[model samples]
Structure formats: structure tokens, C-alpha cells
Target: MDMEGEERIAAPRAVVWQALNDADILRQCIPGCQSLEWTSPTELAAAVKLKIGPVSASFSGAVTLSDVVAPESYTITGEGKGGIAGFAKGGAQVTLLDEGPETLLRYTAQAQVGGKLAQLGSRLIGSSSQKLATQFFADFNKAVVARAEQSVQS
Candidate 1:
């Protein structure tokens, strides 16, 4: 599946970029994320539980960031195994644009699944993916905005 979206965050590009890289914030923002930890400067290990259709599974994955350009853009790739449930692999190109006082965050992603997940039909998988992606970004935006507000008050 393929997806794209953009969000306007009420913070500077640098602040938005920082939040994007913060494992703690990501763990909080990502729906169903059980844990997210940085294994290296450009890599993260994560565990997540998800329910798609009537199937529920826990996935463990490693995410790698490449072609990084600091506060500007990067490509993130991840692969996860869900035992008999299936496996998922995907990549996204994310860009942060400075929009004066706010930041415009854009992303384009592609994903594929195999095993039981692939058998679930593309429509189910696509809609589920979109919902998960939307939830993550919405939560992330709220967290970032709240953090920015707190920093200003500090």
C-alpha cells in the first residue's frame, strides 16, 4: 500500500524535527506502540501490538533512518515479524519544511505485508494502515504542540 499526508505543526522546523527523533515522544504518539528505543543514532527498536480486522498480533521491528539531512528530511525503513500473523515491511520519506513560526511536515510511504496479513485483502489492510498512520500523526502533533507550549512557559 501507498500513502501520503501533511501536517502543520505549531512549532519551528527544528522543534518538530527534534520531536520526530525522540523515542519517548514516538512511543507515546504511535498507536499500540509498547516500546520504542534508540539502538543507535539512526536506528530504533520497537515493539507494537495491533489489531487488524479480526486478527491481533504483536510485532517487533527495527527502524533505520537514512539519507538524513537533519531538521529537514530523511527516509525511514522498517520491517517487523508477527509470528504466524505475518510480516510487514515499509519505508517512508519524511520532510520538514520551515513555515515561518510553524513547520509543515510531509510524508510519502509504501508498505507490503505477507502471510496472514496479505490474505486479509488489500482494502482491509489499506484502511487499517491509513487509520493507524492518521492516529500516529494526530497524537504526535498534539504532543509536539504541548511540548512547545511548555517550553515557551519555561
Candidate 2:
């Protein structure tokens, strides 16, 4: 499946980029993310629980960021396993654009699944992915905006 979207954050590109790399901020922004830990400068381990239609599973995953252009763009690749439920692997390319005092965040992602999850059909998978992606970006935007406001207040 493939997904893409863009969001405008009320912060500069550097601020948004910093928040994106912060594990604490990401934990608050990612939907269903139970925990996120940095294993290295460009690698992280995460646990998330998700429900798709009638299927529910807990997934453990590792994400790696590469091809980075500081405060501008990067590629994120990840793979997750949910035991009997299934496994998924995906990659996303993210770009940041300066919009005056705001930053425009855009991303395109592709994923593949196998096992029971794959049996669920494309329509279900596609819709579920879209919903989850939307939720994640919304949460991320809120977090970034809130932090920016707090910083300004302080």
C-alpha cells in the first residue's frame, strides 16, 4: 500500500526537525506507539498496538533513518512483526519546506504485509493505513504546535 500527505506546522524547519528526531516527542505523536527508544543516532526500536477491522495485534519494530539532509529531508525504513498476526515492512521519504515562520512537512510511504493481515484485502488495509497515518500526523502537528507555543511563552 502507498500513502502520502502534507501538513503545515507553526514552527520553523529547524524546530520541526528537532522535534521529529526527539524520541519523547515521537512517542507522544505516534498513534498506538507504546514505547520508542533510540538504539543509535539513526536507528530506533518501537512497540505499537494496532487494530484493523477485526484484527488486533502488538507489533515490535525497528526504524532506520538514512539519506538525511539536515532539517530538510530523510528516508525512514522500518519492519515490524506481530507474531501470528503478520509482518510488515515499509519505507517513507519525508521532506520539509520552509513556509515563512511555518514548516511544511510532506511524506510518501509504501508498505507490504504478509500472513493473516495480508488476507484482509487491499481495501481494508488501504483504509486502515490511511486512517492511522492521518491520526499520526495530526497528533504530531498538535505536539509540535503545543511545544512551540510553550517555548514562546517561556
Candidate 3:
């Protein structure tokens, strides 16, 4: 499955980019994330509990950041395994564009799944993925805006 979207954040690109790279901020923003840890500068490990329709599973994953251009753009690739539930592998490319005092964040992602998840039907997976992705970005945008406001206040 493939997904793409853009969001305008009320913050500078550099600030938003910093938030994106912060493990704690990302853990808080990610839906169903139980834990997120940076194993290295470009590598992160995560545990997430996900519920899709009637299926629920805990997934362990690793993400690697590459093709980076600082506050401009980067590619994130990850894969997760949920034991009997199934597995997922995906990659997303994100770009940041300056928009006056704000930043325009754009992302394009594609994912593939196998095992029980694959048996659950593409329509269900597709819709659920879209909803989860939307929620993640919405939360992330809110966090960035809040941080910007806090910084200004301080």
C-alpha cells in the first residue's frame, strides 16, 4: 500500500526537523508506540501495540534514516514483526519546505505485509493504515506547534 500527504506546521523547518529526530518526541507522537529508543545516530528501535479491526498485536521494529539533508529531507525505512500476527516493511520519504514562518512537511510512503495481516484483506489494512498515518501526523503537528509556543514563551 502507498500513502502520501502534506501538513503545514506553525514552526520553522529546523525546529520541526529537530522534533522529528528526537526519540522522546517521536515516541509521544507515534500512535500505539510503547517504546522508542535510538540505537545509533541513524537507527532506532521501537515497540508498538496495534489494533486493526479484530486483530491486535505487539510489533517490534527498527527504523533507519538515510539520504538525509538536514532540515530539508530524508528517507526512513523500517520493518516490524508481530510473531503470528504478521510482518510489515515500509519506507517513507519526507521533505520540508519553508513557508514563511511555517514549514510545509510532505511525505510519501509505501508498505507491504505478509502472514495473517495479509489475510485480513487489503481494504481493511489500507484504511487502517491511512487512519493511523493521519493520526500520527496530526499529533506530530500539534506537538511541534506546542513546542514552538513554549519556546517563544520561555
User: Model 3: per-residue lDDT, tens digit, 1-154?
Assistant: 9999999999999999999899989899888999999999999999999998888988999999999999899999989999999998888899999999999999998888888988999999999998888898899999999999999999
- Error in Å for residue 28 of model 1: 0.7
* TM-score of every prediction relative to native: 0.98, 0.97, 0.98
lDDT per residue for candidate 2 within 24-138, as digits (tens), equals: 9989877789999999999999998888888898999999999999989999898999999999788889999999999999999898888889999999998888888888888
Give lDDT tens digits, candidate 1, residues 68-95.
Answer: 9997999999999999999989888999
Would you list the C-alpha lDDT of every candidate in the order shown? 0.93, 0.91, 0.93
Clashing residue pairs in candidate 3, if any? none
- Those runs of model 2 whose alpha carbons end farther than 4 Å from true positions after fitting are none
Model 3 weakest 10-residue run by lDDT: 109-118
Please report how far candidate 1 places residue 128 from its true position, in Å. Answer: 0.5
For candidate 2, the clash count comes to 0
- Please list the Cα RMSD from the true structure of every candidate, rounded to 1 decimal place: 0.7, 0.8, 0.6
| Superposed model 1: Cα runs more than 4 Å off | none
Candidate 2 achieves a global lDDT of: 0.91
